[model samples]
Target: MTAPQSPIGAHVPVAGGLATGGLKYAAEIGAEAIQVFVANPRGWALPEGKPAEDAKLLARTDVPVYVHAPYLVNFGSPSEETLAKSIATVRHSLVRGRAIGARGVVVHTGSAVSQSYDAAMAQIHDHVLPLLEEIPDDGPDLLLEPMAGQGKMLCAKVQDLGPFFERLEHHPKLGVCFDTCHAFAAGHDLAAPGGVKDAMDALVATVGEGRLKLVHANDSKDVCGSAKDRHENIGAGRIGEQPFADLFRHPAVAGVPFIIETPGRAPEPHAKDITTLKSLRAD
Candidate 1:
């Protein structure tokens, strides 16, 4: 039997319909895995997924599915209403993720808009703790994606996760979705020698093993440490192609899926990126 390698793909479009467009695109791009939004990515409203659409996605055993929660979910918000909606949004995403047989649901480690980081973290412990407790054993993991170190971001670098996991009591259902563009933006200097290895080592040392569940394989549009979240194509940005090959060789990435959220119009650019990532990981 062949050993399982990390499946490389992209965040596909679900505009036409979940199964109709997303799955069709996945097939066209030869994606082994994919990520989609359960609802409008900018809205807070919780919409029930179509059972027929859900069934079609669930039946897809060859393609592993993941969900990216709405962009508005900010647990670090100073507003009570926003906090409530954030929790609810995550809950809804988890339910929808399970309905579609998703392995994980990615959410941002949001900003501390108008408050102290300490106060924000306290509120996070008070509110998000119970939310984390609500996750069932069989449910899809809630994958926390660190930001690009812009503004008052709560979590950006790998080390920032230590405090978060400590506060959440290291919930078993909690996992990470590492974004290469964000890491490069946050200044891991992945373009430098041993950068990928050092960062992976630090992640394991802090979070221990198995918390790394997914990867967003994107190139950076800005220079390292610039705190910009712009994403370019696989090898056509500040983060050259060599670092991705380094990522593939890391032990922490075993069985993790690399889903590109890069700039593209779709089928062609991402398909080309998927091919590039496959070639980098190939033996």
Candidate 2:
């Protein structure tokens, strides 16, 4: 199998193993970079390490690998038990990611629940900053991905991200994984004419270009500002193909990997989506 020409890929499954299943599937779909869930995404299970398998996967290609932290991670959760678990889970994800030589570990910027946004941010800062400070220079970056703009969601809009960054003192290890669908759900309107570029501009202004690391390239099943997180296949949702072309041409995304998180049961749809996006790349 040939490696992708651009740093674009899909969130491939790790049902078998990273070396044997996930990386192989990535190659089959022409992915140059890939994202995988190292542990059960719905649980707080700490990932088991297979050093030999990790070595094999790491040695197979120069393609980048990333880890998506479990959905149960909610650093902002008001419940003390849940909060502690969230911190532990994120820390464990980082450990696993570093073992596999992943470039970054992505976690959702979670909800405030019944707490006020300020209170939630305070809790997040208390728990997250120490973790960030502990990261060795060689370890993978902890990428904060904004969630759908649901009730009391922290970092729901690009503007909401500023305070969190400030709390972390703009630590270099703290990076961002920009999700297109979530951004749209947060009311960024990325599908409208010139909307993609405008959104990129806002990101650069808010986080600076350097902190923007990965892209969760997806189409929204819901309309802009709907606060829903449903994802659709490329060009098959409310966010059509044109915005993706704009995405390809945007200078901010240059050298950044666009990892597709769209719905599909097989590799064919992913392959097609990757090809379509590649065809639209300007350079």
Candidate 3:
């Protein structure tokens, strides 16, 4: 089968009783791509299932697939135990990602805990680089997702990711997952006129277009630069509709997937959001 027109998808349910069922549901809902967690979103336990068959089913689907690492993973942690577990989890995710034919694996650029900023950066460089080095080229590359400008967050802004790229020595496989809500919350005026274009230009300048792998299409519940992480439905929150249109129409993201992480009580609620995004694509 031919690949879908674009990598436009939503973060459909993949936890609890919805694991495999969610993937099928997403495909049925016209997703060209999809993101799911292989295991519990909060816990550290690895997922238990049949990989070969799951991989076969996922591969036969029309859309590309991606896996989001658990929220508890903090690769930048100063604690040795936490760092070790984080590395293991990342490695496991990469292995599973390859087995499932996933295009990429997503992990948050975590915090430095209560440690000094410099110390935290040092720890990240010393510890995280080696872990990333272990990932084979055949496996999926890790996508560093920046969070809101929260306390002790390692990557609070798009520019703050410079050190991360530097620490990795600008590894070709290391890419970025730019989240709309996070960017807006971190002081990028994505809602204002020229804001979306300016932010995209800044990102291209900082990391270059080649490393721009994924886009997290989320709307913020709080105002821009509020440092909040709340996600609202598309065009219903601080990001508004025009910025999203600009974002989807940008040439940099032409073929990239735009995964929706917005709130929706039912699949029907996502219809409007998906339609809005689809309309932004060029004819």
Candidate 4:
């Protein structure tokens, strides 16, 4: 498929009523793409039910839509029940995403949940490998989102993904969603001069450009390597705007949708942020 010329978008709300309203809001705000939770973000409950009409609304919308999986899923959890639920949730997300014509399903890189590093790694391989094979080729690409270096999180940085990819044997359908705030909190230094470019280069070297599927664009409330996942509005936090401008212009991430996960100041803040990022795109 041809890549988009500009990939700026926002995270529209999916809390009340049908999700069709979210897509309508996104398009009305002039977004070229959008992200939404298929269900409650913090819960593991499988989608209670599917709304064909809602899916139809998404299909008719002009912008691309992506599904952000619930936060409770820890694919690398030491508990067998948690791991099983995580895998099931991922599959359910794929089905829901495909039904809504979403291009990708985003899941956090997840934590080891207090286990030793080796055991965590082993559990990931043992559990995830077989599960991945069950995913159909037509399903939305699984976009792994690296979290901040908090707690026992795996894939703490761009470099940390190498081992996971190696363990998965470099599955072609596997891709990554780079979150700007999280990257900064993981100590990539995007706020420093030339830091954004360097971080992008490091990501390209580690996972290559093809696997870089999406970006979560947000300014950070925490300092670099703070291991906190707090997000602030663009240009309103420590990350600043310069790095985001650099990131917006980078060829490596050009066509990948940059979904804003920042807090809104008002009803139209989402639209304003989309405009700001769109203006930053390389001409």
Q: Highest lDDT among the candidates is held by which one?
A: 1
TM for every model, in the order presented, reads 0.97, 0.95, 0.93, 0.93
lDDT of 2 by residue, 1-283 (tens): 4222348898988776877778888889888789988878998778675745775768868989899999999988899999998988888888888888888999999888988888888887888999998889999999999988888778877767788799888999999999999999999999888899998888888888778789888999999999999998888989988888788777777778889988887789999888877777643
Residue range with the least summed lDDT across 10 consecutive positions in model 1:
51-60
TM-score of 1: 0.97
Per-prediction CA RMSD (Å): 1.4, 2.9, 2.8, 2.2
Q: Is 2 or 3 the stronger prediction by TM-score? A: 2
Clashing pairs in 3: 7-257
lDDT on C-alpha atoms for all candidate structures: 0.90, 0.86, 0.80, 0.81
- Consecutive 10-residue window with the lowest summed lDDT within model 2: 1-10
**On residues 74-132, what C-alpha lDDT tens digit does candidate 3 reach at each position?**
97787888888887787778788778777888999999887777887787778777767
How displaced is residue 31 in candidate 4, in Å? 1.8
